[model samples]
Target chain A: MIKLLPRYILSFILLVFLQVFILNNIQFSGYINPYIYVLFILVLPFETPKWFLLFIAFVLGLTVDLFSNTPGMHSSATVFMAFLRPYVLKVISPRDGYESETLPQLKHYGSAWFIRYSAILIFAHHLFLFYIEVFRLSEFFATLARVILSSLFTIILVLISQYFYRRDIKR
Target chain B: MRSLLNFLVRIHFLLLFILIEVFSISLLVNRNSFHKARFVNFTRQVAGNVFVKSNNLKQYLSLTEENQRLAEENNRLLNIIESTYKSDEIFFRSVNDTIFNQRYQYTSAKIINNSINKKHNFITLNKGSEQGLRPEMAVVSEGSIVGVIKGVSNNYSTVISLLNLDLKISSKIKKNGYFGPLMWEGQGYQSAILNEIPLNADIQVGDTIITSGFSSIYPEGILIGFISDFTEKGGSFYEIKVNLSTDFKSLDNVNVIGNLLQTEKLNIEKQAEQND
Candidate 1:
């Protein structure tokens, strides 16, 4: 646990930096803005306490909100994602269930399970995020398109990142 | 009491989730209201500092474009001065310092951050109360109106941009004086919708739209846009499309307009309302 603490802290800083400095600047057309910051919560250890997970998620979302100037949009969406994380894990758990010390990574879960897990949470996060952002139902279909496109973009980026990290962990 | 404590322990995580969500929703809803003034002001200041630092690094890349714009503005000003001199001596002499009471004063500021994609777009300016800026002051770019000051802190301020759906500017045709309210339809940044112009108004595709000066925020005759197209709305009013004069994407420098008589004018209007 002590050894893992520093690694988590380092990745947290790297993820936030990448999000605010790079990803936030990339607007693929006007409708799609990929949000990869939620990956921080998605990759947490399966046995982590629920209260701790929620707290970390809130802080992460608030930090992103502060930098992006969106106030509560990111935080609200992130909390919703965190709240649904345990149930998602339960629904997709393997025959013997997840190990206590292992984090949810592509290597341990394989490609199929990992993809389904990420898709469910990412879709939920993006759906909540884009709706809260527009704050109106008048442009429902337009906002829905944004949510779908942005979720796909973010999932692709997350999967590619997982591949690289998986190799590093193997080495 | 023991059972209550046990139940509380059982639902602790759910309770925590609800509490955090409630806090976030409150923050989101109170963003545009007076209740969160202090919170928004603090966030703006912190975010403003970071953007100013980043803008300093990035602004160097756009130096050439900025210089070209400044040069063009200078030429336009010189042409206006020379035309005034040739047209009327009385009007030219009225430009003298003692003759003019200077109802509007301008403070120059640079835009550190701006957004065009959102429905309610806002621009962040570098100047704030330290530079005598306040809420409701008019902000203009080189030759066109940009927005009005919506909030101000000590070192930075936020302008509700002209592209915002919430902003409606009173505008009129410069040729025939048929006035209407101009608003953004939350589509592209280049065009906006002008409504309430009667069908009989002789408006053309290329007629200029200038400020009506009905509101105390902006002065009369500031250029807004030009008529691009018009169609009758329900056979009574004209639903005209306007091509905005100010290009918001490349905008940088702006001048905040401070009206000296705003307080007095608002006071008199309030008194008249009481009598009515």
Candidate 2:
């Protein structure tokens, strides 16, 4: 736990920087605003206590909100994702139960398993976040399109980063 | 009592989750409320400075484009000065110094953070109260209307962007002077709707739209956009589409217009209404 502190802290800072300075400015049209910052909540250790997970997710969402000027919006969506994270892990657990002493990562699970896990969470987060931002049901289909496109991009970005992390472990 | 304690303990995590979500949603709903004002200042102090550093790094990449825009504006001003100087018969009589009361003061500021894709978009400018900025000032790009100042901190301020659905600018047709209120429909950044133009007005596609100066904020004759399309589907007015002139994505430097006479205008109007 002590050794994992620096890793989580470093990723948190790096992801926030990447989000505000780069991905935010790259919002393609009004359709695809990819949010890869939610990756932090996606890859937390499976054994993380539920209450602690909710707190950390709230803090993470508020951090992104501070930069983007969308107060409360991101935090709510992220907390929702954090709340559902355990159920998602349980539902997708393999037949052999699970590998001992392993964090949720592509190295422990193959690319296929990791992709499925992250995709479900990312889809849920984006769907919830966009709807809340829109609030009104008038542009339902338009908001849905934004959700699908943004989720696709976010999933692709998450996979790319996971593969890169996997390569670093090989060294 | 033992059974109730067990139930409460069993659902503790769920209770915590609900509590956190309720707090967040309250924050969202009360975003523009007074309680969030102080929190917004905190956001301005931290996030605003970080944006300044990043904007400084990004500005270098667009130096040439920025210089070209500045040069073109200078050239246009110079041409106007030269033409007026050559054509007018000026009287060089000495006048009282008290006659030169300045009505408008312009403060040039750099945009540090801006969002064009959101329903309620905001722009963060580098200058703030220390730089002689106040809320309710109009902001404009090179020669186009951008947004209005919303909140000001010590060294940073936020702007309600023209793309925001909550803002409405008084505008008129440059060709025939048919005035209306221009508003964003939250559809796209490049377009807005100008409504309340009388149906009998001689309107055409591509006619220019300019500010009407009905309010104390924006001055008249500043170009808002060109009329892109219009329809009479509603009541007695034409719902005209306008292609906004300012490209919100590329806004870098803008001028904050301080209308010094706004207080005077409002006071007099209030006095006149009192007699009625």
Candidate 3:
């Protein structure tokens, strides 16, 4: 992803803008506050350096935190998700392996593969985020219900958003 | 030496990950206390400005609703003045009123950013320290209590919304004289849990909850919420849920309250405690 900084930067700004300005305002219910910005981490190129991946995740999470007034909550969750991304990718890799010609996009990798990949990371992020925000085990089950509901909502949002990203072959 | 260097290089990314996670978690843990790192304040300013820009576009959309609320509040104030006005009062009998001179000052602010869906919700206002705002001041909407100011920048301030789990406000049952600390239990934004009122307080379903005013933040008897549900739970105290009156969803403008006597009260109280 380092070689394609300009393209990723555009997506980064666009995704954060969408998350803070639009999605943050859309409260379907108190239980499910969808965070579609995790899509930025889910779509990183397969060959991204481990250090760079972690750095980008930290900055992205911090940006979300700064906007939402949850200082370290999003950053911690995003970094945890980024640290687990390579392992998740390895476990869910295609039998024929990733196509060098295609990045991790719904069109490139098929909807099923993309869903599995995004769902795992999104669920991990949401679970970590909700638990850490409460910082107590007293409301364990309620928090879990929230995590599960929000994760499902975020996954659907991430999937629906894929249709709107214009496929720019030049990038 | 070469083998050692290779192992260090191989695990360097793991080290970076650990370092960043530690830093982020430190910020989270540190936030539970009164003091925060300067970085968080800086970022809050940046975020506040962005929210102001965004809210500017949407300001017109809610103008009518906000105006109506303001008019309602004005009518209520007018009624209070009319009821208390004594045109035939003695001109020399101002002795009982001089002690009540301006105990609480109010500064109006516009809500620029707000979130109620989170376990820890916050409301950001467009007015900040430059507008004479300070942390720990009470924030009230119309005649009801909203939250307390938590942090303030030059141009913005963040409030720990009454909906947040971490906040607790001193409150009382208006029916009887019993008082308690009210806290949000992460139930929906409309409700919060009030504790420490004894079972014998003769409470009713629609009884109002108001600020105790024993604490210096909010002035005495400001409306907080009403008892929606109650049971004799949590030992001796009644575990009552209050239906918050301020519709946090539609909130636009609020007044930040500054208690002029807080410092003097605290100083005297501290001396008394030391003597004890």
Candidate 4:
């Protein structure tokens, strides 16, 4: 528990820096801007206590929000994803209420399950994040387009990270 | 009792998530006019440091073009300066005369980060509060207007770019002074729509547009853009498309005007509001 905590913290910090400094600079014609920061919440260990998960997700998102100057969009989106996570897991249960020792990964849940899980979470996060950021439906089509494009970019990046790092779960 | 305790513990996260989301949502809804200037300034400082390194790298590759442009500007200024001193002294006495004072003041800044492709665009400048920058100050480039300052920190501030949908600047026709509000239509980055101009106004293709000076932010007569096309919408107002003077997609260095009278005007207005 002690070792895993420090490792996750280190990676989380690195990811946020990479996100704000590097990925934030990448805007492909406004539509395909990816926000891979939320992957921190998506890949948390399954055995993580519910309260701890919520707290960590809030802190993670709030930290990014503070830096991006979006104030609260990321936190709101992240918490919404965290809230819906359990339901999503239940809907796509891996044969049973995940083994206590097992963590969510492409290897454990299969690529199809991972896709469904990540897609739903990413969609929910993007939808809420975009709507809140704009704060109105007046430009509904434009906002929807942004959400779809950003979600695709974020999902692809998250999947890439998951694919490469899935085997390194020491805990 | 143990099962009930476990159930309660399980739903605790759900409750916590909802609470945090509510707090964040309230923040989002109330962001405008929330006086988060200090917070934004701090964040911009952090972002500015990161961008400075990258902007330095970018400047290296574009050095030749920048030098050429700078040389041309230097030559033009030198010619004007030399001619002013020689033939007629009183005719061209001080460069800081009424003509120079009436139109604008320029302070160059590097565009560390800019967002042109978003529905609501914003640009970050390297110059900030430490450089006499303040909220509502106008920013422009050599040939075109860029945006107005929304917030300023000790070393950086965010400009609400002309491409932002929410931005509305007072503008008028250079030929006739038919004033209207210039706003983005959530479309192209290079173009914006000037609305509320009377249908009777003679707006020809390529008619010059400049700031109306009705708003305190920008001085009247600063070059904004040119009319690309115009069409009467609903037989009432002419919706004229303006090709922006500043190419936001390629923006690098910009000039931020430090309006000396801004705070005085704001204070007077605030006092009047209090009295009323």
The candidate scoring highest on TM-score is 3
DockQ ranking of the models: 3, 2, 1, 4
Cα-based lDDT at residue B74, candidate 4: 98
- Note the DockQ of each predicted structure: 0.56, 0.66, 0.71, 0.53
The model with the greater DockQ, 1 or 2, is 2
Better of 1 and 2 by TM-score: 2
**What are the per-model C-alpha RMSD values against the true structure?**
2.9, 3.0, 2.6, 3.5
Residue lDDT tens for model 3, B15-74: 998999999998887775523557767877888888988998888787887688779989
Q: What is the TM-score of chain B alone in each candidate?
A: 0.86, 0.84, 0.87, 0.85
Q: What C-alpha lDDT do the candidate models reach, one value each?
A: 0.87, 0.87, 0.87, 0.80
Error of 4 at B222 (Å): 1.7
Candidate 1 is graded, for docking, as medium
Better of 2 and 4 by DockQ: 2
**Candidate 1 residue spans exceeding 4 A from truth:** A167-171, B34-36, B74-100, B232-236
Q: Could you estimate the TM-score for every candidate?
A: 0.89, 0.90, 0.92, 0.87
Candidate 4 off by > 4 Å: A167-171, B1-11, B32-39, B86-105, B263-276
C-alpha lDDT of residue B53 in model 4? 85
Q: Report the TM-score of candidate 4, chain A only.
A: 0.92
Docking class of 3: medium
What is the Cα-based lDDT of residue B185 in candidate 3? 89
Identify the leading candidate in terms of DockQ.
Answer: 3
The pairs that clash in candidate 4 are none
